[model samples]
Target: MDYRESLSTGPEGSMQAHQVSHFFSAVDVARRGRWDDDALRQLAHLAIPEGLLGPRGNLVRADVTLAQARWYLEGLVDYAAFEQDESLRFGRLALQLWQALVAQNPQIPRDELHEVALKLATVAWSEVRARRIRHRARMTLDTRRTLWFRELDPRCYLCGYKFTAGARDRFLRRSRSPLTPPPLVDFTRPRTKERHLLIEIDHMQAVAEGGTNELDNLSLACGWCNIVKGRRGSIFDVDSRPIGMLDHPTLGWLSVPQPMWVLRIVSMRGRCEHPSGCSANLANSELLVAPYSSRGALNPANTLVFCGEHDPWKDERLISRTLVV
Candidate 1:
């Protein structure tokens, strides 16, 4: 029997499954979108091949032929017909298409172009293989998601909007399939609308930016916020800082490092991270979690929270030991 993927239904789950495979070619594979914000309003119909997101209905991206792009890629490396590795096939194709799109921008050095192209290609491969990747570790993924959902039915870590449970289940279900285009929901309406009410979990650190699946690297997000936040990925930020911000309730405004930096800043809400139950409050503010020595970059995988009293930073020896490098 032949198998095929299905498009999302209009909230009814009755969409017919066609063996449709779209040939996506883009002028900006990484979606650099390098124009002024006003360009969106002023030039809505422009097709910026060098530095923009989509073709703006001009289909600037769709014009590139995948076969021609593949030929260009073959010029760069040893041509491999019927390459056994699926990732190798798709990734190089993505790179070639990026090169083809950037043909007019000859000022970009080939080395720099190749580096960025590979980064973008890697993201595509991760998403394309997300189902298979998750299936390999589905048990662990589901367990973490289940436990995470049980604790938070309150507020979005990013926007501080209070919501109900079950979004975890919804998001997990959605993750099992290919990425879907958002519904034609008008976001300008009230926050209580169906789109605004849906909550989804997001990576505190992006996959393209070397973020892992550790607990510290995950946070709850409203459906809309997650889409807006995760849209550009880390392709824009060179320093690993998130381009998104959170207008928190008590904190006024906070930079969304993990979408839940508000909660993380308080060090597990001012409690000790001890394995055994400890009534001690985290008063010292200075906290520590390991995989310690990095080249000036913090790793969210080993992040921990604590309140004020546990001044772990005071211990010069413990601090030194935690530094792996």
Candidate 2:
């Protein structure tokens, strides 16, 4: 942590700032010193945020095998740092140092960071030195594996190990260029509208039974259908056309084929959710209106959209419709 001895004036000699080169040299000396965990912890706490540490406390953990610490430090330098005026030999040396550490680190096992950087640097150098042969396939696979783990669950389904979200995001941003856009609907839409519409995608077929994960398999169901279908194949009749299920995305209150009667009902009633077991009380006049009528059909296309819940007094009615249906 005390870098006083590590400091020296540059060639012009006016109290030279410690360059990354100087920091790395000091770190090598520190790694050789017999510093306890408490001393290492203090060094990490003081050094990292100021950008003195390479990243992930790699320099501070002197007890860690030299090979492992070097891998992380090397991986930290990417295209942006590569663009700087630093020597090209520096990058090459850093990666080589990391590879040496990987071969040497026993306490801290070689992790994915080492594997990726080694592969990428190897391919990059080969392309530059060996007549530009295409060797990006391995790099692409590694990148894809990184992305899948980010989007999918982090812990291995078979084995449990914590994965960092920050690491995933960094990998995604670097590997895929601009990361994939956020979800389709922004959750921050204003609540003041007359009817706030909630779009939920219901799978046409349950994914558990050979259904592919794609946009086509998705259908926008209103909040009611989304809640009702939770984690189970929705109830469908003998023809395989879903019964007791709303065609949420494509046909709102009516079937996908578009029944004329249902469409007319939906046009007047907005999206209707006749909660299960509620016999249509034709006697209730207040319940049947622009955003809350029971007359809408079960098709996806005819389903209503953008209707915010406006009337406070009718909150009970809205919940009943969406939840029970």
Top TM-score hit: 1
What do the candidate models score in CA lDDT, each in turn?
0.41, 0.35
Count clashes in each candidate, considering only residues at least 3 apart in sequence or on different chains.
11, 24
Worst 10 residues of 1 by lDDT: 316-325
**Candidate 2, which segments miss by more than 4 Å at Cα?**
1-197, 234-325
Best by lDDT: 1
Model 1: how far residue 324 lies from native, Å: 52
Per-residue lDDT of model 2, residues 174-267, tens digit only: 4323222223321111112111123333454544333433545543333323343444331121122323433233224422222222222322
Model 1 agreement with the true structure over 154-261: per-residue lDDT tens digits: 445544444443554455554333233223311111233355556666776665445556666766666655655653332121233533443433333433333322
Question: Which parts of model 1 are misplaced by more than 4 Å?
Answer: 1-153, 165-195, 234-325
